[model samples]
Target: MDKHGNSYDKALDVFEKLLDEPLQKVLSGPLPLARAVGLATTSGYRAAAIAESEGLLSRSTEGDYLRGPSTRTIGLSALGFGEFALVAEPVLIQLRQATRLTAFLAVAGNSQCMIGPHSRGRGLTFAVPQAQYYLPSLPVLDDERLAEISLSNRHEAVAAQRAAIAAVSEREDRQCIVGVLLPGLHEAATDDLRAHLRKASDLLRTQSEKLT
Candidate 1:
């Protein structure tokens, strides 16, 4: 079985793209492997296999793959309905509304930061994934600029991402990052947000110990 939940986001994207076709047809019959693959134009065989082993799909006696329990589980989880998301989304929303900035919640997984629930500020053009994870050159927690929320207004680098504080969540328990982008932050903040973002990594740890 595929133990790691890597590529789940991409695989799910492929799944959603194909849902209107084969998945609809398969409601009455077993979906052919090739047909399933054909529908997933962006996904590879390996990704399909991973989705299968993860319970997103199941091979029938005839070798056809069918939707399984994990599909719904993963879907709900992706939509921020899972235990971790449910607990974390509120905090993320609160932070965003409070700051009127882009607020995001990400969890640490596989040595990478797994993006989770998020809120967007007005005029925010970019988006972060709740499915994919980013492996920065250095850990978000290791950064020097954390715990100082006010610094973001100055250099935009130190105060911007503040990876140091977010890294705390990744320590012994729920390794998650909660970021709030200031209204004045510019496009450069994108790199900071993507490359080194932080906040509430410690809060997640304190609030949700079960997340680990």
Candidate 2:
């Protein structure tokens, strides 16, 4: 059984693998179905056929596999139909406008962060769109400590290419990390940026509480 108490099913595992492989190499272009069916068993090929027929996977003209219509529909629905996204979107936009930097909300857990809704900044920005980041240096948060983290200088050393300042707020049993991505912010403006980020995070918490 998994953490959700669902029994493991091999067929579902193979199906998920097929979807994940192409997405992992999305920038590199389509992946061959055979390659996606890593360690191809009889069941693997069967799963691929069903996924293609159900519009979860599509084949390129040259016969390589990429995500299909169903994936797009699901992604769109996730962004459009969520109360969390709706509440965060306006706050993110405000944060971006105030700081001239990309602002985002991510679900923080399991030593990794999965970025969700975000507002993009103008000109050049170091925004990590639809990306998952693993930070070994970040310790698991206890309820009391889920307030904020000043990750500007520390994250500069950890990520090397990006710096972020974020705050964690729990609302309706969900822990959301709201932050801003700094492209090339001046050292003097760090304090102002942190203030804006905190205000945005507080707005999210207040709005989310109203929904409950």
Candidate 3:
């Protein structure tokens, strides 16, 4: 019997003996012993019987089986994979404050892009408030400068997002890379937006380092 009160030691000994034999020879050799043990109503008695039959346990003159030092098989439960949110809430708030422009957060999950909390500028004359829009497709950008600004300002976040993006790129359901962006900003404020995003990214990076 094992520490768990199961006769796994005998079962292991029988299994090891069976493993030494070739697959084709198993049926004619120790396989019958294993099958009998597996079908036994009492697992412990079955294991002992298999061990004795397989010559793993010695039989005494009185016909009693003597146990031997052997390994055992222990059952294990499956482990769960926990979910984690990489970007912190403070980072989003900082990005909003720094840019004074609309800021968005996103993550890649289940072959789709999930947009998280977002903030918009209070004084903006144009542009709609798109807080939690799940864009099944990638963002359509008419201005190359704005795209560059977004990438540059959210460098670290973008890097993590790109890694996730690369994982799902081959799949048909895969969405665009994860990152933050400002929608419907003015063409004239592209440079300023870029500057603010850079500042926000830098601040976030600094805060992250301190936490480490």
Candidate 4:
């Protein structure tokens, strides 16, 4: 038995092995035997009780177990992105998970902008103070190097002017302008990033049209 009352090593091993299998397969197939062996060897029951307390798992009315809805929601939102469908909170969580990095959702505020909410990856900590000031300018990147330059000098007046031009040039259906800042990136990666952002924006537009 280990600190969490389960054979920590065994539980981790089982968890890692089962990860490649679908949850339904693990729940309905012989994987439970592995779990049982792990449990018997350690404090599996105690660990399960603790997990239940933490809302990580739950028993169903039919006596089957399943992950909680919160977990499912996060999973679904990870690869899904649409502006209209993007609830700030869940999408932010999904972004952090998918990118394995910190992320933010900023919106225009009173003569400035604000980072509404953000999420950080597992074991990562972000120390940006709350209500950090955001400039009311957007960035346009004609190339990857420009993107890097815009982000590195986000507060500079010239960079802000360039961003504003880029945002306007890239605008489609609506005039909603926003800039994305990525850290430690090089110019070579700009093409892929631009393609992804364009797709994301399109998805958001589609969702918005459906709503109205």
Candidate 5:
């Protein structure tokens, strides 16, 4: 532990690594006791007991451990980026799982995109640093990049690149754009790619709309 008593922070890190489901859903999966014992100095049971007592983890009615109430709310208020990430997390996760690619939610600001929550697919994935303020503009080749940049700042992107589809959520807080990676989507004509991307983008828009 740090001199400032950051044990809770460490515990929070471990708990996040254990999650395999959306925070809004009840976790039906159970993590083995070994998962905690491997990290904490204490015994597995002791670690689990302490985590549960502190509300960092919850014990289900079936006696299995899952995400506690505190886990989802941990950093919701920490920063603007964090709040946006938390709100968009469930969508990004489901998108990655469904499409098998890297998924991210970002906001379009003056000539750039603000990165929010993101997830990786089964195939090779790339990452951007947290301090990155602008989004990377992937080149348009074959099934490579989505989102066409226009002179007016209208951001249009492909859902295939976005994986399970992504949309710009309609909200006053910020104009957010979502993107997903499309693996194995190669060697297609540009027109065909645009068609596919348009469909995917529409789907993502619909899904995000439902959430709002």
Candidate 6:
């Protein structure tokens, strides 16, 4: 590849790292561009300048970096998952209304869950600091458990949180975890939460299939 080609490839890598980093930290404050892009200061700054010129990144007042407006536009654009969000938003709203709890959709990893679109409930609520979390209660990911609903609980700051998660296939190579966040863990409330989650998951799965 030519020199220009090399620069282009490095710029692409920077964008990938920008997306891969925890969104909460990205939004919270400035991040070290050199370390984030895995390049030396001079090279990383050069790559960042290229990305900034195209609106893929923005520099903080303190000279750190974060995702720019263009990134959100692309994320919600058709090229991303905007269509799925359109179909899922109504279901999420309904789930929130029915259960009076926060209803959310996330991309689940082995032990972490990346929070996505969500409907917040009234009163005291539990939300992720950075919209991504490592919930110890979340079931481990496995081929056999990919499409099954899992229920679990974890305590945070004296309040017990209960979650009902249903992992379903989103695409041939992707899957999503649809879930609800409740304030407390109560045996009496588990049944209702499970029922609502099951219904919502079914709607999401059915709607997701049509998109593919």
Q: Between which residue pairs do clashes occur in model 6?
A: none
**TM-score for each of the candidates:** 0.39, 0.50, 0.32, 0.36, 0.39, 0.50
- Per-model clash counts, in order, read 6, 0, 0, 5, 7, 0
| Tens-place lDDT digits, model 4, residues 18-113 | 332223343532335337434442454555555446555555665445454444334323323233224444544654555444544443323344
Compared to the true structure, candidate 4 yields what TM-score? 0.36
> Residue 156 lDDT in model 5?
41
Tell me model 1's lDDT, rounded to 2 decimals: 0.47
Q: How close is candidate 6 to the true structure, as a TM-score?
A: 0.50
Task: Put down candidate 2 lDDT per residue, 119-201, tens digits, no spaces.
Answer: 77877664555566654435334342323332332234444224354555543433457776557433333667767866876
Clashing residue pairs, backbone N/CA/C < 3 A, model 5: 147-156, 147-157, 161-180, 161-181, 162-179, 162-180, 163-180
lDDT of 5 by residue, 1-212 (tens): 57556877766665565443323344333345434334543444565666677766777577666655455445322322334433455666665565555666655544445444566556465532231243344223224335543211224443223222233443444445556544434422245434544554455566645554
- Candidate 3 per-residue lDDT over residues 107-181, each given as its tens digit: 333423444334444465223333233333443333331232222112233312111111111123332222334
Candidate achieving higher TM-score, 3 or 4: 4
Local distance difference test scores for all models: 0.47, 0.59, 0.37, 0.40, 0.47, 0.60
Best-matching candidate per lDDT: 6
Candidate 3 Cα misplacement greater than 4 A, ranges = 1-91, 108-111, 125-189
Clashing pairs in 2: none
Q: Which stretches of candidate 6 lie over 4 Å from their true place?
A: 1-83, 124-130, 135-161, 170-175, 185-189
Worst 10 contiguous positions by lDDT, candidate 5: 150-159
What tens digits encode model 1's per-residue C-alpha lDDT throughout 1-212? 35355567655656664333434455332334435445443334555566666766665575655565565446436543344443555666665555556666555445344444466665553333334434433343334434323222222334333322244333443444566544442323444443333434444555555653
| lDDT score, candidate 2 | 0.59
